[model samples]
Target: MSSSGTGGSDYDVVISGASLAGSAAAILLARQGARVALLERRSDPEAYKVLCTHSLTACASPVLAELGLIPALEKAGAVRNEGRWYTRWGWIEPWAGPAGAELPYGYNIRRSTLDPLIRARAAQTPGVDLLLGHRVTGLVREAGRAHGVRAQTAEGEREIRARLVVGADGKDSEVAKLAALPVRRHDNGRFGYLAHFRNLPLRDGISHAWFLEPDMAYAFPNDDGVTVVAVLPDKKRLPAFKEDLEGSFSAFLRALPEAPDIDSAERITKITGTVDYPLLSRKPTAPGLALIGDAALTADPLWGVGCGWALQSASWLARAVGPAATGQGDLDASLTAYARTHRRRLRGHQYLAVDYAASRPFNPVERLVFSAAARDASVARHMHLFASRLIGPSRFLSPAALAKAAVVNLKHRRAAAR
Candidate 1:
């Protein structure tokens, strides 16, 4: 429980949100010898995002390991997944190829279970103060430069003066709103429902996701015999679902042939749905302020990209801004670099997610590739790498791969045409 009393310019950085990105920034900066004040709106350490499925793709595994969090996560009972994808055409199992050629994998855990653990770790780190129940009221700017943040806690109003302010407040970020940064938003007319279950059958440590026509469903096994189930459908179907939520969700799950393995599992929590408009962010930085996690960009959750990006963005921001905060470079220059690097690394993934969000059923190109994967083990391995986010779309569209897909598709069409 390392912390400091209010009313001091001793801290170098003041983070507005103390969840994933905020706490991560605090930890990283503090480890770099910068004093930090981490502010969390909720007083309870247990308070966290409940609507998340908490799945991370392979891209973020190294980032977490670099933060020295993998050991803590393992100790907290996180599970590594080899990845499993199920589609109407067929199931794409984990690639059993050479480990070196195979893409590195990621893991899944409950956010409610992971957040408190991270916050606790942040509190233990030297030079970091974990302030709970503190809500940011406004930004403190002088001559268009962020100097600090004004927050209200049970102790009344207080100001944290620091070299920088970090916003990890989530998709609907209050700091982003207050700062008046232009947020680019694209909606897919979709919504997501998530809940947890206990018991029932699932391959140990493997996660399952079903691509059902226009609908998407995922089942993630977490620690303590708990599994998270989520369903995402076009928003137009929400009205009927509202009338009978539980039944609607159950029916939706049952409708997916591949979802039954998860549906047959025990229900430990009531099903819940989120119809909030999914928003994607473009610029995540200001002169002396920066946004991280979903606060920076919220992609279509159908890909389960948020948790991983939160960690990745936090790590990237920490690296980009640490020197500036330490007075080695221009703050604005650092902020610009952070925004550019983030876009460069994440734009491809976001593009793919957005394209898939369109209401159209599987496109012809996707059908051809997936059909080939269903028939050939080599193709399935490639699709596994592509779907797991180990490789980009272009890599999967190489001349040889496309030629193979075309041949496989012709055979399937001939069999059906006959």
Candidate 2:
């Protein structure tokens, strides 16, 4: 890796936390001929985030294809996943394959394999200097604008200066804290637990989820014949889960309406869980600094949108500020543009995500729409697009669509009565 002395403004961009978002931004910026310093806290190249669902939604396929990583991921045994959502009414399964002519199916892969793949790609990109074992201690601010970072490494402290500093760090980001950006948080009332299991029957590349009001569970078929099973129960049920983790998880799955036979499957990993997952939304940009991925916005884990949003946000920032990093545009204007774009594209989605994080039963509108989707193929297609992140809340819950759903339900009720 190229070495820049402490406090030297040598690189165009310095990105902290080189996992998915940081690595992606580094690769894109470097490819655009901007010198980049990608700093990772962990020295081990194989290190991965252990507490993730690792499901990449269909919305990310285009971004992955553009980055030239999809083919490699598929070769490494990533599984394509079609979604099947089970509501209280019935199951809503969209047609498998491309949703339209362009979008490919979603994917499920273990993070143990995914993190290394992205990190290696970033390290190999031209003009990118990968600095492993470097943890950012603080931001370097001059005249109220961030220009670099003070990081600690095995060899002691060093300052890496750049024209732009990006915080692609996770939820508890030191960069965001040091920058003192405004933040908004929504309470999450659900706790999540997950484990990898072998010997579980595959659903032909389909992922399944049961939305049993105030509780939810999912099974995702991942690489190498392993399925990831997760349960998100209300906090009120925490005592039972804490008493017997494995038993409680199994019973929870078995108790679902059309339960999967997980009791016959052998778990390959120890169960892991988290209870303090509040939804966070941070301002995306400051003077010479920007935030992406979970550092900028983190919603509920139950939606499984984190991984895809990380890549998407990285792509957005790279596109928005690539020319500015290369000295062709106004940096401040570019940063403001990125912030506006991020908010415009994601605010609606975040609202719904945080609302669901409360683990409340479906509202009247949700019940009407979901039930109609289950009984009608046309409604199911529209609903699938929204659930897969291809469409926003406004488009999904449009007046025309809601009216059609109501009509479909009325017809279904008449048919049932006969």
Candidate 3:
């Protein structure tokens, strides 16, 4: 990164993939007075990621609010969701916090709706140039640091120069690949199938998750009276899905306890699935560049963490590098700060998520805690906090929390003797 004034740059920051993370980062950085170029490979502003659950967790609520997106999202018919989970033991209901405090709720909207809305916001924000049909071809590097990107546009090719480059692209990131960032790969043992339904009567404004040992399923009620039903069954179940995609998917959901009535609901979208989803974590930063969203880390999609983390990571990147990108501070130090923040906030969560993606049964600790949470509202509140990404495992597994869980389980066991 340049160590002095930002006079020689076409822009202060050039962000690749003007989707959730890129647009959020561009809006945030430009708000802080940095000139930003937001590039998207797709020409249509309406293009969206189809292979997503689009369930933003509670942790991302504040960032959306900060971006002034709450009203727009609501106006666009996005659903607000508090979460409920069913385990082998029982249901862990969404708990109201102490003293009648409401739990944080997240948005449940399809990427088809969210992607274009967020991108439009970025385009409307001052200081951000939203470039569509701009596919990143190569990184502009000097002295072992990325300075910008070479992009293929509607016209001829162009070289976009900036003081700092940002990769907010998805898992198969061209920027991360071009930067030669080290990546660790972890394969998922289970596969997923997803579709939308109309008139599927899920609980109003609630997202339901069933952790049926090695398998998982969800019913997310989304915008415009539509509901999303998905299943992530172990590989052994793949044969059934392969035989009949719609039948197998409906069967999986219908078999769950308190399952929605799929028979009565209208299937709104064709069944879409992937058998080989994997976890990928890339080194998030180099000398003059930083990566955000799935480019930084891709966790198992079953957990529904991608959209939430995209907004959070974009916020963190903007906060860390805003001054430096505007030529008011050292870019290297800013990049380091962004990297540290990314790892600190997400590494622990990713470790646990990757372990679960193996399609293994829950370990002893998880069994104890989850069972206890189903029986006790206090325990459930803490569990929701942790699962929603508002709190990390350290706090969720704190000595006091575990001790309380043990007591709750003991009391349940004693009562069962009657």
Error of 2 at 230 (Å): 0.3
Task: Output the TM-score of candidate 3.
Answer: 0.97
> Where does model 1 exceed 4 Å of error?
1-10, 98-103, 203-205, 261-264, 393-404, 407-418
Tens-place lDDT per residue, model 1, 1-418, is: 1111122454678898887788888889888877899999999988888888787777778777776788877777777766667776677665655666655677787888788877888899999999999999998887786778999999899988877888888888888888898987777767888888886466545777887768778888887778888888877788898888988888887777645555567798888767865557758888778999998989888877788789889899888878667665677777888999888877777876777777567888888887777766778888866766667767877888899988887887898899
- Candidate 2 structure quality by residue, lDDT tens digits, 58-112: 8878888878999889998898877788987888866633546432467899999
Q: List the global CA lDDT of all models.
A: 0.79, 0.87, 0.91
How accurate locally is residue 349 in candidate 2, as Cα lDDT from 0 to 100?
A: 98
Clashing pairs in 1: none
| Candidate 1 accuracy as lDDT | 0.79
Which parts of model 2 have CA positions greater than 4 angstroms off?
1-8, 96-104
- How does each model score on TM-score? 0.91, 0.95, 0.97
The candidates, ranked best first by lDDT, are: 3, 2, 1
